[model samples]
Target: MRKPQQLRNRELVLLIFAMALTLGAFVLVQFGAIGELDTKVLGVVGIMCVLAFALHIVLRIRASQADPFLVPVALMLTGIGTAMIYRLDLAYVAHWNVGTSNAGEHQMLYAALSIALCIGLVWSLANYRVLFKYTYIFGFLGIILLALPFIPFLNGGGNAVVWISIFGFNFQPGEIAKICLAIFFAGYLVRTRESLTSTGKRVLGFTFPRAREFGPLLVIWLISMAIIVLQRDLGTGILIFGMFVAMLYVATGKTGWVLIGVFLAGAGAVAATFVMPYVHGRFEQWLHALDDDLYNASANASFQLVNGLFGMAHGGMFGTGLGQGRPDITPVAGSDYIIPSLGEELGLVGVFAILALYLIFASRGAHVGVAGQDDFGKLLSVGLSFTIALQVFIMVGGVTRVIPLTGLTTPFLAAGGSSLLANWLIVAILLRVSDAVRRQPRAVIG
Candidate 1:
């Protein structure tokens, strides 16, 4: 194993570069939005930099052998998101006359809190494997979290019942539920891999698991459908199901599991279009976005989608430059539509850059999982990484019209406190796993 000090030094160098990238972005936003560089931008950028360095320091003391790229990649994505939101804030105040919108400032604060949480988790969690002990407990807790938004008193949000008010702050419990569920799925799959992989029905070169062993898959599918139907949230439902299926495939090394999951998911989606007006409307808007009647409709129209398309089209290949594009014209531009907002300003090149960061992050995580010495660690790491990858695909694909828009927040890049916190915590978990993987001794064969 390499020396911990050497790894920490490597991480420190990358951290400095990531901070510089963030600082440069803030500078660009300031100059482009206001036509002059203002020192006020430094307030948020400076605080974020301080918090980021503080996290690096914690990693130095606690997890020196952790993967260096994860932190830097996450920070870069979050920085780009904050810069874009800041640009939108300036536009909102100047042209839209929405003076009360301080979303950019609030996002900085949320990023700080998220980083602090990451520091605490990395500092306190001595072993990622300890979580395996509470596998069933986490599973139960995930169910409760997912159900919280259904409670009449706790449930609060428009269009989707995925938010709950806690201490006067609105949060999406589904975001937290995904983590708990990932933990649960990883641990559960570790315990059941043997049976899941046992020989069963062989159909056209694919060996499917027996009906007796299919309870878990069926239950998860039902839960996902319930989310889409009861909560009107297709993204989270699909996210949870996809994470489990990916982890299951990793555990069993079986391609049939993925096929079964896709078939179920496709069937559920088709059924949803007929059973739920919300799902049908989204499909309608997606398929006929350019049609005048649907596009111009007053209620549940494709206006937002059309505007987002136009915004990205206006940017073309290079982009309109940071803060110069009118990204705020789309509804919920800071959250679900943040990708298009970024696409419009950063252009195809910038969007590809952002996506490449996410790809690197996921690749690093998958590497950590493969290097893990224990099955539990392997499953957990892979499950978490798949969660992030699946989310980016759903959001970016929706914005580009490759799929129906499911209103999922872009991980680490969207303006949502719950999402930021959940994703940063995932980074913390991966860091711990990577550190453990590096610290383990290789076998010595006599």
Candidate 2:
């Protein structure tokens, strides 16, 4: 086997570029906000630079052969997000003057903390295969985390039961749960790939897994439905189910499992429309977004969806120029609506660029998964990468009115601590897996 380049030096070079991108973003925010550079923006850049280098240090020590582009891709997106948040913060201050929360400051702090967590994740897992040992444990923990938001005392968010509030702090455990569930899906599927791929039921030229092997799929689907039913979170539920389906297909190379999953998911959705008001309401809004009565109704209206559409339209081709667009007119512009906020400012070009970064990230992750030497590593890589893909699609699709809006944050770009930390870990895990993929050829030859 031919040896691939070590790429550690390449990663360092990219790290420099990534830091430059982030710095540039900070400067833009400063110019857009106060029309002058702030020492605080410089401070944030310094912190990001330190974190970027620290992450590079670990990559050099450990995952030297990992893709050089992953961190840089993530960094550029982070910069854009931070810049937008700062713009919104400035807008809030200028507009209301009453709400003085420095969300951009919080975002930078979260980025630092998230980087530390990502580093710890990278440092702790010298071997990705160790995760395979506790697959069931991860799955159990995932279930518990998902359920936590449903409890009365633990839940806080009014919209969906996805947040947990403790003391003075609030977080969305579903974010963390997605990561754990991906790992569990990967590890478990790796263990069972043999049976899952084997011949059993021959239905119209498709080979289905044996009846006994269907237990895992059944359980996963049930767990997904539970989240939908109990927590009223369609995005997380679909995300978890979609991750499992994608991982399962990767593991077994079987289309049957995917078909089964889709059928069940559709069946569940139909049932949900009948049983759950929330699900029905979303569907109503989605299907009748432009209907006179429905759009203007006092309750279950598509006001948020309509407003987001209008905001994007107002943004136009080149946007009103960053920090100048009225993203604040859209609800929750800092969180779920950040994309629209960005679209309003950055326009189509900026939106496409942001999406391109996501595409590159997902493709690189897919490349890593396919190149792995072991089944578990392959499944894990694919699962983690697919996790981001699913999320970006769901969030972007919802805001654009292409689909029903489910309360899901855009991975790195959206303002949410749980999302920030979780996505960073996803990047960390992929780095480790990529390193393993590169080292495998050498291990075999040696």
Candidate 3:
């Protein structure tokens, strides 16, 4: 095992570099320069960085060997997140008079807590196989959590009931459910892969999986439909279902399941569009953007998306520059619409850079999956990676008008505590899997 001092040098160096890059960017943008130093926020972030370094030191000292890339990756994500939040806060301050409001402070707190939780989750579990032991419980709990936002008493958010307010603090349960569902799907698919692959009947050019073999997916599809119809949260329901379908295909290696999943999803989307007013409105607005009557009458419905496109266009190649662009004019600029805000401030080049980062992260995660030693680890890594990729695609595509808007948050870059914590937890799980892969003996015969 490497000593804490040895690990501290590397981790601290990475942290310093990340912080310097983030702060330097802010200074260049001139957004974070004018605010009162907000020492309390700085103090909390400082302590978190110190603690993260300390944790890396302790972990390195204890383990005989660990993945060298894990700490640096984590630091990069945390740094990007902190910088994005700070940037958004500057806009919030200028427009909404929300200067020094506890959002940034709370985000830092969530980051620190998420880091601690990640350390604990990775350290306590001796093996990846152990997750399978509680898959059922975790799966059920995930479904329940996903449904919690629909509960009348607990539900928050007007247009979308994706949040629940607890003691005046809002939390998005769907974020956490994503991880739980990934774990469940990974474990479940691994356990059932052989049976699912063998039990299906072949017809034409495809294998039609047995109905019993399709029970879990059927249930998921039904639940997704229910969510869309009842909670009116098509984004989350689609995300969960998409993740399930992707993992199932990976586990079974059957293209039929993928086709079936797509067919079912298409049906659900059509049904929801016809029956759900919100879904109908969004679709109509998306498809009929040029219709003067619709644009004139439902302008409020189309305002944010329209403004978001305008902002992105205004960004051209080099962004208008941070604080100089009218990103704050876009509704929900700090959350669902943050990508356009980024495009407007950072320009198309900056937006492309951010997208490039996500691509790098996704590619690295896929590498981890392919390199993993076992089905469980591989499936888990792939599932997590797919979730991040899909979520980013959904949100980015929505804001850019590549697709109809789905209110999904950008992974770490979006400003929300639940999202921050959930994403960090995901990265932690990925590191754990990568560590396991790294430790595997190279010459072992299967």
Which candidate has the top score in TM-score?
1
Q: List the residue pairs that clash in candidate 1.
A: none
Best candidate, lDDT: 1
lDDT of each: 0.90, 0.84, 0.76
Clashing residue pairs in candidate 3, if any? 319-347
TM-score of each: 0.97, 0.94, 0.88
lDDT of candidate model 3 versus the reference: 0.76
Error of 3 at 18 (Å): 2.6
**RMSD in Å for model 3:** 3.4
- TM-score for candidate 1, please give it: 0.97
Backbone N/Cα/C clashes per model: 0, 0, 1
Model 2 residue runs over 4 Å out of place are: 1-6, 442-446
lDDT tens per residue, model 2, 269-297: 88999999989999999888988898789
lDDT tens digits, residue span 1-446, model 1: 67788778887888888899898988888788888776776777888889889999999889988988899899999998988888889889988988567888889899999999999999999998999999999999999999998888887777888999977899988888899999999999989988999998989999888998889999999999989888889999999999999999999988889899999999999999998888999999889999999988987799999999999999899989887889999988998889889899889998999999999999989888888668898889999999999999999888888899996899999998899999999999999999998888862111
Model 2 global lDDT (CA atoms, 0 to 1): 0.84
Candidate 3 residue 220 Cα shift, in angstroms, is 1.5
Q: C-alpha displacement of 353 in model 2, angstroms? A: 1.0
